[model samples]
Target: MTLVSQSNEESTCERPTSKYAQYTGVLAATLAAFSIGTYLSWTSSALPLYNKNDTLSVSDQEGSWISSLVPLGAIPITIPAGMLADKFGRKRTIWAITVPLFLCWYIIAFAQSKIWIFLGRFVAGAACGAASVVVPMFTSEIAEQSIRGLLGTIFQLQITAGILFAYATAFTDNLHVIAILCSVAPALLLISFPFVPESPAWLVMQGRKNEANDVLKHFRGAHYRTETELTRLELQASEMREAKASIFDLRKYQKAICITLGLMIFQQLSGVNTLIFYAKKIFDDAGSTLSSSTSSVIVGAVQVVATYCSTILIERAGRKLLLFISVSVMATCMFTLSGYFHFQNSHDLSSVSWIPLLSFAVFIVIFSIGFGPIPWLMVGELFTNNVKSAASAATAICNWTLAFLVTKCFQDMVDLMGISSSFATFGVISLIGTVFVSTVVPETKGRSVEEIQIELYGTQISSIPRETDPEV
Candidate 1:
């Protein structure tokens, strides 16, 4: 991507191109998501082990803390991670995540006591938190308008694969082996991530015009010139950087912020994480004939398959429609699970023991299709370059904070209120999520970042229509 001067509008150079050109940036971030998936699902497999005397004997309360601490540790780093992404560059901040991630696994692999384990999880949480904010920002910056949704959904696809990988480790009984194996993901990511170019948008924001052009050329290919997109990115960056927006100034974009905050909150409140973290326990309690580990593995496999299907469909189906469908189905699944649990709690239902497993499978599939990926994808789309880091950090912090509350209280809620009421509450939350997306979120399919910002801010008319050519 040679930065062209105003006078040199034409070049004789042949355009360098590849079929995979558009996926370069998101591919790097997907590697990091693999590591995060391991961390997120680690507690699921570890919980059953913790209760066994062969491993560290932990009470139910202590196990809940293990699962919840990741989010708690994440709250503090949310803003700092965003700042680092802005100051150092997205690639560097992302690579930096591997250090703590490495330490987390080694600590768990070698720890003699529960205190060391707690500390390990906290560090892992911090890394996961940082990655959550930076990966989306980087992926969003690099993806072109034409395939943005396809590239963006890669984040969740990698996450699902990671969870499936963790579940695969359950086949082995050794905790040390599982920890050591999972640790390799981050190590692999750290070594390979540098080969990918830095985000062109970030380079432009830093006033490194020539480097930004080079990145654009690399990602966009030799045939496509960077002139139009580069100019727009520079203009957008200049406006955002010049404004000197702070976290507090986010209030100015009231509706956008509300949407960001709402998605983050609703994403967790839907009980996806709670179900994931307790997949084994939930399956075990449901009186299913299949072993708890086998049931949990099935759920993980379904998530990966479902996310892959969504990755293919997201570009075609449009964000709003997929979200509406995902949330509506998810609500119905929640109610189904609630009914199953209600029946079990109130009377003998030995004849229909399979309802929970079937219900969970349906819920996981529907959730993957939309609610799983779109919320994070939008985090990258909704904000301008200048405020993107700050706004995403705030949203990520809210996400983790709420996640902490839900994970910590989930088991207790189940014990006190019964699984029926607990799932019923999530069912209602899923219904609300449907309403929020249907009414508030706009269709961002096939629109440029500038166009999306213009439409949401209502500041000016954009040429982008409701419908656009897929190739454009």
Candidate 2:
């Protein structure tokens, strides 16, 4: 199938009258991500309360389960969530996410037993998993190509904001109160998101061309050329439909699948989550002047700020450049941290106690800019409509599974190999990730879906631009 030429399309279309509608819809949909962030990080604060036997007594083993269950719960629902997004539409699947999110908080707020707590964490994880797939898809579809990167990055920004919100609220130390507060994110989404338009791309895919035209007008503003945009979407949808792709057809999408999965693999193996999961312990072990709680808060704040910076820079610096810089600097910080730990094992480290905290803060900042958000953003950018859902599901599963494995094994690696060696290993992996980004990952900045698909498939659509060097 032929694709529309970007230059011709742009020449035909008028500038959007306003971007406020797109911004508002993204804000509304990403509330689910905000809710997921609170759930993912909730254990950092709530697990301590559980262990204290104040509200409900939880054994150390049970606390571990409660903390890990979110990713574990995410695994089972991710594929199904992707399927639902493709079948019912991204907005509907996102709306369905509220059920588990609400149930999660309700169960946690009223729980009298550890089983109830476990169930609560699991369902919260399910919602997190589902949102991971649907939110990016929804945002990507509704966004104009010019600002898609900025909008896609907002998903990660909301997640970081939610994490910081959870960290900030830990001072309350009231499990029920925190649960109730976290529930407000989803509650707001439930109230506001219904007013937002369904994805025009999905509407086009479903052959609802008139509705897609109307929705495009809503997102792009009345002055925008809805017919031109709709025609492009129609061609893409028809091509994908004629391909009739299934899970078995994924072999045809190996390049995208591999690129996406590789990014997810490197994202987890870079040890960002290891640092997040064990931040307090790492801070305490290093004997930082700042309290572990204070350090955790500072790190969370940095993450939010840095991810916000990513949204600003992504459209400017481009994805591959950011990934390369992010991983390279992250590798340096990891090695620096490893040296500190190695020295600590042998020498008094009071004078350089600041090194660990500094290293962690810098590592988190760099990570938030590149490895943390780009992987997810690309999940929405890299694939065609036919295989996008499967690819996203596979990417989410890879990410969560690696997250669980890394988090679970990190302590064991520290015990067996020493903290120094464990961090150095992560450093080596991150160093390798830099090479991967430079060699394999393509830059998606300022590219449309058809342009990206042409690069991935090596199909020469006469109307579409040919792939060029990322540097160019």
Candidate 3:
């Protein structure tokens, strides 16, 4: 039956079973990631000696290295995780993803040496890499087209929320306690996620048609293979599985691959993570009367509230409009921050220190709403079946690599050019990103993966319009 017939004739349809079941997996993914996100983003600000000692002291880079190394590990792990997700079911992939992280947490919590700290950081980072690629792809495949943006964006939305909650948790817990708390999160995957169904798309790829049918039935609460549309999804999955996607396979889809990489890199350049991890230092240098810890808390709170705002608007306003608005807002914040810091450089630090805190608050809020959530959705929607696996791997590399640079280099950059120059540089980058988004970004809101594939990578290899973005 067609969607028209099923919708019009079925009164007892009782809604799709997966409508609710879908959240089971995403909620699990979100909880695991949110816990990680909070711990990763806030711990730098919350680390006991950070504010107690000047960053110039260099006595405790080991603690900061723990947070920075997480993003660095994503570079090497993304490609392999994507491949594993393809080989095993998403469920099985997730099953193995967090095992090493469990051990990493215990080490990180108690390690005294820099080497041991880096070891834990690298391992936990690998676990998150697997989860990031698999969970979003899984969410995209299972979600209905109507609410896809909402569901997809929710992962990122919660990540920002996670940053806030993690920062707040710092008020009470020390590093060891935080590590223990963060370590326990992945245990949920061990206990609760097994009861959830595997991604039906993965089942189709394995030629397990009978299993796919049963899984679909469990999710949709209806008999499987009722429509050709549903069967087409299965066939698409089967066709792609046969394609033998690999690192070299990605080069064939160069333009789409570039777009994916650009999406990830642009996300980092927006200064969202920089603002989160370094907000305390930014505020301290700007001469905020508020203590660094208090200022950091304010910044985290702003991000959480703004991310929630994005969650509300994503489905209604659509992806393009929101990204445009978000980038514009971010640019505004960056400029404001630059101006504040520039003024501080010329005047006494105490006279205008409050300016940086206010501007940083604005920056975090703008970042939380648009740039924060849109990039993940863009990447999730950009590629066709042939290239998504490879593209996601490449994109994950771009995500982690740039994140590492920002995380690892923020302190060095501050030392070299001063905070005023750092904020100025980021402000300029945000404006440049606004231009990139205007030119290349496609409107993926409500489009199916197949439709988005055609939109982004058609026969003649045309590109999306720069002015097609919402703000332009």
Candidate 4:
């Protein structure tokens, strides 16, 4: 009857004394995140080479299609990726991501025609779409509540790191070398991720309680038996009632869905990708003294540093505080940048030549700290386990959809309305996002999935109590 006694399933795997063992799956997922980052930014390097008359000689039309195809390809795959993650297991779906991702890099590395590059970009986009869903869900299900926020943000951090890798590689003259180098990320992930544990929550749902307990023990260490964590997970599984998760079922967690989808929309509408896709052009247009490539590298470096900063501060300052701050600061930065552009367009550029560079640098840092990382991190935290896969997929699709629209329209908006007007439009969206976070989005730091759902439900979700909520 002792809670501490070893079951037959656990006897084969000795319980460890360390807490760090819990993060093995997180570490493995972080590798996949690196690959996602590479997918996102590799184009920055490759596109220039494709434009070379002696190279692929892509027309402007072909170049734009190559760039936009990623999110377009991502749109269709997200829901399927989510379903696969839930049904087959998070670990397996992640393993599958490596194939398409590797193919993406290798195709680009060896491509002689725009057609091959186009197909490569689509495959890369599919892998990114899959990773977007699976990594957060896997990380959420594996992490201890105390460190969940910290671990979840690592996804974004690795993405920043991957982007930086690509930006740095742009210094090399050979585009093929850059693509081949990016290939190393997925190749490493494919080789190493098998060592990571399958999600304990998924195992419990599969009715493999003993195996779940053993995995939980690995994550939580020797003291695991004394905790109610395993029982709570089993109860969560039971409460799900073998319900087949569908996109329609999201209505059950409407508040959670609204906040998640709202954040996704706001995040994209705030024009993060617009700035990223045209960092060099923005610098050149602004007449920066720094080389465009250097400015881009600086932007990438700032993002990586700022994302890591958010990872550290998130668990401490809390999600709501950081998000509010990020949105407010980003809006302010956009308005400032807008003003700079307006002045540059209308007046002498001598007085405020420094403004654009400074504004963009600060903007990248502010973005990396909150708006960049928290939305995706919260996707993993905001839902009940039953709807997690479906909800995450839906939100990711919305994310990619907006990303596509924004990237496609941003240049035209600048051309039609002016750079100042386009940025001003984004500024308005960021301000609205600030209000949304302040009014609707609940703080989720240090809360369990069940606890967060109950808070959102504003009722007894099963027997979990409102008064006993630790994260309140």
Q: Model 2, stretches more than 4 Å misplaced? A: 1-14, 54-60, 222-225, 253-256, 318-321, 342-346, 377-386, 414-418, 435-472
lDDT by residue for model 4 over 374-400, one digit each (tens)? Answer: 887787788666666677678888999
The TM-score ranking, best first, is: 1, 2, 4, 3
Please identify which of the two predictions, 3 or 4, would achieve the higher TM-score against the true structure: 4
TM-score of each: 0.85, 0.84, 0.83, 0.84
Model 4 TM-score, 2 decimals: 0.84
- Model 4's alpha-carbon lDDT is 0.79
Which lDDT tens digits does candidate 3 get at residues 237-265? 66765764566755546666666677677
lDDT of 2 by residue, 12-50 (tens): 566677889999999999999898888877777676666
Best by TM-score: 1
**Each prediction's number of clashing residue pairs:** 3, 0, 4, 0
Q: What Cα-based lDDT does every candidate model obtain?
A: 0.82, 0.82, 0.69, 0.79
Pairs clashing within candidate 1: 15-222, 15-223, 16-222
